[model samples]
Target: MLAAAAAAGAAIWLTTAWLLNTADHAREGTDRAKVRVDAVRTGLAAGAGAGAAVGLLLAFRRQRHAEIATTLSDYDAAERRVTELYNAAAEQLGSDKAPVRLTALYTLERLANNDPSHRQTIVNIICAYLRMPYTPPLDPTREADPEAAQRAAARRYHAVRGNARPAAQPTTTPNPNEERQVRLTAQRILLDHLKFDARVPWNKLDLDLTGATLLTFDLSNCTLSSARLSGATFHGTTDFRGLNLAGEARFDDTIFSGLTLFMEATFAGSANFGRAIFSRQTDFGGASFSMQTSFERATFSNVTNFGGVTFSKSFSFNGATFAGPALFSQMTSSERATFRGSTFSGYTEFNATMFKRDPAHELDETTSGWFDEFGELVFSRAADFSLATFSTEISLDGAIFSGDVSFRSATFSGNADFSKATFKQAVDFADAAVADLSSPPTLPAGWRIEPGEGATGLIVNT
Candidate 1:
């Protein structure tokens, strides 16, 4: 539309210019009367042409804006409907009516199938339902309908007696015992939905596990694309080991009192654990995130080991609390990683880790936020430590970050050894306090420290 309007405007402008030129030439040679008439005609045509061009452009712009608005509205409505269906399914699972539960599941499936944006959400909803244990032992003594039971028994007996099988032997065809097994097996299929494809619209389906108690919800080799688990309680150890997720996997306001092992889990997705509590030890020793991940405002009451973990993506740990000894000794991250406003109550190690930048921008103004001292490595890029506290020894023996580093307003209660650490650019430890001797820890030769009143740059050779 814009193109059409622009073309019309150009044509009108050119015509007006040509007519004005003709009028001027006539005034110089032809009769004054004819020249005056030609001038008036040219003036009127220019005014009309310019007016029409301006009106057309305005109309096209309005139309474009309205189209955009309509698209956005449609998208919003679809997203809401998807959410409604998901909620309905969750409620239906708790319903006593079997038909209603089946209908809910059917509706959820339809919603997921219809909207590409809600696909991941539907997957999470289904998985959540499947994970909910709901199996009751059958009683063979109960007979609601004696006549039907007798008929079924007679048929089974005839089928068995007519065959060459012994009379005492049970009929092997269509075993009733297998009927319960089939149902259980169907229920177990829910565990397969551990992750979803991020290419789908609304890739992240926020999961809420609030008040949920599972003795053990095994999601091995499952895909949890965008699963929310807020305020949920896992009474027994929850095994999410060897799982792959794609979208946002939230665990906010949740409680894990038992072992929460995520060993060998791959998160090619965003992971959040904000304001969650882990009362027992948590292990993420071999987990990997290929996208942005966060643990903001989380509380860890026990040992949390993330050693040998790899974050080939952006990561954050803002305002997190580690109440016990935490380990992150050999983690590797390729992009920006932040641990600002975090409190570590135990020894933290960043030994033998590589923090690299994207290969495309490897040498550009982009610096890594991980590296150590003495030309070794700390964080590779813009690693911030604003107002972080370390209760025990903090070692940056073999860390590396290639950008501006900050330890401003940080407090370290134990020895901080940055010996053999390298600072690629500016290393700001201004207003930072560390418990060490006067000749504080060995730092990068050219790095500047904003010495505060009685503040020492980590005692050297301590």
Candidate 2:
């Protein structure tokens, strides 16, 4: 539009100049001068009309563009102001002033669509305020001094601002039950926080879980310092990964279901789970179990990884079941450890699992009645009995320890596969089984069980 207007104005100015020149030329009496002058005058009037129309249109367009730009700038400024006001109000709403808190909440609701983080904080604060009881009716008599009244009001206001209340002097000797109630309330608050976001950091949190059922709990990346979780079920996909549990930690009847990960966790003091059940795949991978640790009747359902785990003192897993493949690969056990009545259903791997005690650990001698009652020393299911150096007399006397117990080139410094190896000794059944006993033993012809030497009662095909 502007371009058209400019073009029309230029034509008008040119036409007016030409007309005045023609009139002057007529006065000089050129041939056909009167006719040229009349034509110039008519062109000049038309040009004037065109110029007026173009000037009005150009002015109108400029005004319209200016109005549009102003409107946009105003909108942007208003948006920025609202954002600033909401943040300021939110930060101060936890103040003792009731009116300020109300205003902050209103601002949060107004800017809810624009920003969500501020809105969530407002919601949490409001919920907390609602939970507080308006009880004990402000004790004006208790405030003997005028200044005391002001201080009391100020403290009440701080409660709204998310500040912890200052501990007050007990009016009378306090009962232990009151202290217990306070701790219980704290624990409840922690659980509420967990329901919203399990990743909440609860550093230096102490809880008394006398009869808590933590079924299917997930405390991933949580810091539970001085937390007492006794007689609680740590069951069902419970994620305690990377947790630092300082002080006493107890889990007496806990059940682990599915992949219960305790990866890279630290246990400081006595941690006990006398009868725990690990139902599915569990990874205590890279966990440090310090102090006394006990797992007396724990049942492991699937493949379990105790790899890279460190036990500081006495550790026990008496009467545990490794129902599926169990891996103690590269695990370090300190002090006296016991795995007395454990059943390994699938392949039981103890490859490079280091122990503290025996050199030639017989299955029956050190640990009593493990193999004697169950007949076969059960190593039947492709056991990875590789490079596991036992420290004492370990027996596999009676339990059906079947499968191809791969002692393939395994250096057993103590009594090995002794009580009743279905496949005869020195048969060199490196890769062969007991079923091939009818034929000449697969051992090299010269290899024989030494007659009166220490390798006694050994059935070798000499």
| TM-scores for the candidates | 0.43, 0.45
After superposition, which runs of candidate 1 have C-alpha atoms over 4 Å from their true positions? 1-189, 192-213, 356-462
Q: Write the per-residue lDDT of candidate 2 for residues 1-462, one digit (tens) a residue.
A: 666556666666677567766666564566547756665666666666676777778788889999899899888887688768756865755455555555655565456435444434433443343333222213322435789778977877787687777657457532333323332333344444333244332235444554454434555555555555555544346777876777777777765655788888788877886777777788888888888888777878888888888876768776677788878776776555666566667876766665543223334556653221212334436666455543333444444555655433333332334434343222232322222122212233433332333332223334
Question: What's the C-alpha lDDT at position 33 in model 2?
Answer: 74
Error of 2 at 338 (Å): 1.9
lDDT by residue (tens digit), candidate 1, 187-235? 3434433334323233334444444444455666566445667666665
In candidate 2, stretches whose alpha carbon ends up further than 4 angstroms from where it belongs are: 1-203, 225-227, 234-236, 357-380, 409-417, 420-462
Q: What is the C-alpha RMSD of each candidate to the true structure, in Å?
A: 17.4, 17.5
lDDT of 1 at 250: 72
**What lDDT is reached at residue 462 by model 2?**
41
Clashes of each: 58, 33
User: Which candidate number has the best TM-score?
Assistant: 2
What is residue 96's positional error in candidate 2, in angstroms? 28
Ten-residue segment with the worst summed lDDT in candidate 2? 431-440
